[model samples]
Target: MGRMTDQPARWTQATVYPDMWVDPDDDPRNSEGRAPDGELATLADFLANYRMTLRMKCEGLDAEQLARRSAPPSTMSLLGLVRHLAEAERDWRRWISDGDPLPKLYGARDADFDGAVAEPGEIEAAYEALAREQAATDAALAAHPDLGERLGRDGIAVRELLVHRIEEYARHCGHADLLRERIDGRVGQ
Candidate 1:
């Protein structure tokens, strides 16, 4: 059977909330308050939410499912997104480092995605790298509370970096949503 046969008879079978990954009541991404009190808090919240969404989208899938490409002519996969985001987070940490920037996690362009093969150790390592990089980046960001102050050799503003981080996560999260839905017909916010 082809890829089409791998899917459910109806896409709706695996969906809830009109194909949502999780019900709103139980979704960890949902928050009760307004967009926080300031620019930094709001941006942080958005980034955090996007990160959680990415994890949720990858939940309950095996190695093969996570690494499966969405379609021909495209190399994108949920596992690739996870690895790519790890690289992105590591870059942010390096960008904000007080001293010399850290070396690239994957050490090659597109390696984050391209190297996301469906292997036992590969999946675990990807998740580990993502978590590690995210924590490091968060710490680096927290150390420089002043969003307007510049960091790194390039002197880019902290606010700009945060916004860029959010943008990257947001874009990949969208890609993840589609990839998950295609894999099993499960979809949602």
Candidate 2:
């Protein structure tokens, strides 16, 4: 949640920490990966890990830092990622599960990232949006348990979407890692 401005040097009590962002013993997100007996369980596990990784990277930052664009020329901020994921979650619900062609969460054409400006109360709002969108999407996915069965007009399998969701989160988590590192010297997870 805090930043190390120098990026090159920061306090790490030891070089070998157990997890990204914190030691495994202290990380709330840390857990033993389960031996999933089904495709849905496996996909859900990875998706949840990456999803929580993003949130963990955002811990303790104020709006200014959250909205701070770590890599210049790229509109990807930690907050922006949060906002984008919120849109993504909604997209999954409307276009994939529900098959409703609704407008973008923020607006058209990357508005989720574009509109991710630093403002008072916006950080909390974005987090809330992400949570809400994820919950709705989760409920929809839970409603249809057959992973091999295709859903919606896209002809994408439920299993495919679940895997895609994990991929999406993992990609964003990578961005968050570099961004958080640059914003402050802290890096991990």
Candidate 3:
């Protein structure tokens, strides 16, 4: 178990997300083929799949392992990524929906990384929270069919929010790759 203040000298370097999760040599967005019925299509599909990619990258790791800061000066671990995404999803949701006025999920601005340290069930809880937030955000988007529908103070279009969500997930998935590699020697996806 990793304590809040105990840092490991040598972190395990392994890759968990395999090539099957993504095309061996193609961008994840285009790796999977389109559905013939087109029912399984939309910007949401891309965003959801990308989020799944990040989750897959951290699969099978214990809480301590997931929380290991494989890369120095970056305070990022699979666990931290999970917590950060959960917080981010909540923030975006609140921004898009009025009357939300909810306090941030992981506490104050810097709390995301602060609460990222390891403990039993921490990993599972973080993942579960992220999944719930993702589902809520998806539902909110579905409720408003018109992409042009303006939401948030900045007049953020629903379409733009969806696109931004996808971009965020895609970028984090890339970070997950390096984090996993640093944890253990495994590498592929």
Candidate 4:
């Protein structure tokens, strides 16, 4: 993969994060179009959109390109972001699902981004896995439309879970902005 050098005069807007997760602009749910009738429409909309933004920020890059650290000593890369988000989705789902006891996808805490590499196959697989997890999480959330439903180990409400997911995506999108800028000086929504 070619490293971004000499910033392009005309920067193309990134619709997906380096991992090719989702586009930033389109609706997170129903990115292809608006949500269907009777769908549980609420704060989840924002969260879905935000997650799409994070994915858009990392699109169109190869494995090595996605793995390039934005800054020295940061260990943060687009690929790492994908892996991190995948683990997070899994964790949140587990929390909401009453501890299904499924084996950890990335193994324990902090291991999500520990062994991240720039291999093409790994990059492709990571994004694919992230998409699958995101779909499953969305489905779980959709299954119980009642925002008042209590999920999570601590009795956290489903509404809180949706909000937290949005917060998570928003914070990472901020990181993505800087990472994208460092990669090739591209910026904005």
For each candidate, what is the lDDT? 0.84, 0.79, 0.73, 0.74
Candidate 2 lDDT score at position 83? 94
Clashing pairs in 1: 19-187, 20-188
Order of models, best TM-score first: 1, 2, 3, 4
TM-score: the better of candidates 2 and 4 = 2
Tell me how candidate 2 scores on lDDT.
0.79
Model 3 lDDT-worst window of ten: 6-15
Model 2 misplaced regions, further than 4 Å: 1-8, 11-20
Give one clash count per candidate, in the order shown. 2, 6, 10, 12
Task: Tell me the tens digit of each residue's lDDT in model 2 across 1-189.
Answer: 987555565443234572356666665653754566777777787788889899988887778888887665778899999999999998887546444565677888877877888896788789899999899899988878998878887777888888888999999999998877777667766
Name the regions of candidate 1 deviating beyond 4 angstroms. Answer: 1-16
Task: Name the top lDDT candidate.
Answer: 1
Residue 101 shift from truth in candidate 2, angstroms: 1.4
Q: Which residue pairs of candidate 2 clash?
A: 1-59, 3-184, 4-184, 4-185, 20-188, 20-189
Q: Cα lDDT of model 1 overall?
A: 0.84
* Local lDDT at 110 for model 2: 70
Clashing pairs in 3: 12-183, 12-184, 13-182, 13-183, 13-184, 13-185, 14-183, 14-184, 14-185, 15-186
**Candidate 3: segments with Cα more than 4 A from true spot:** 1-30, 35-40
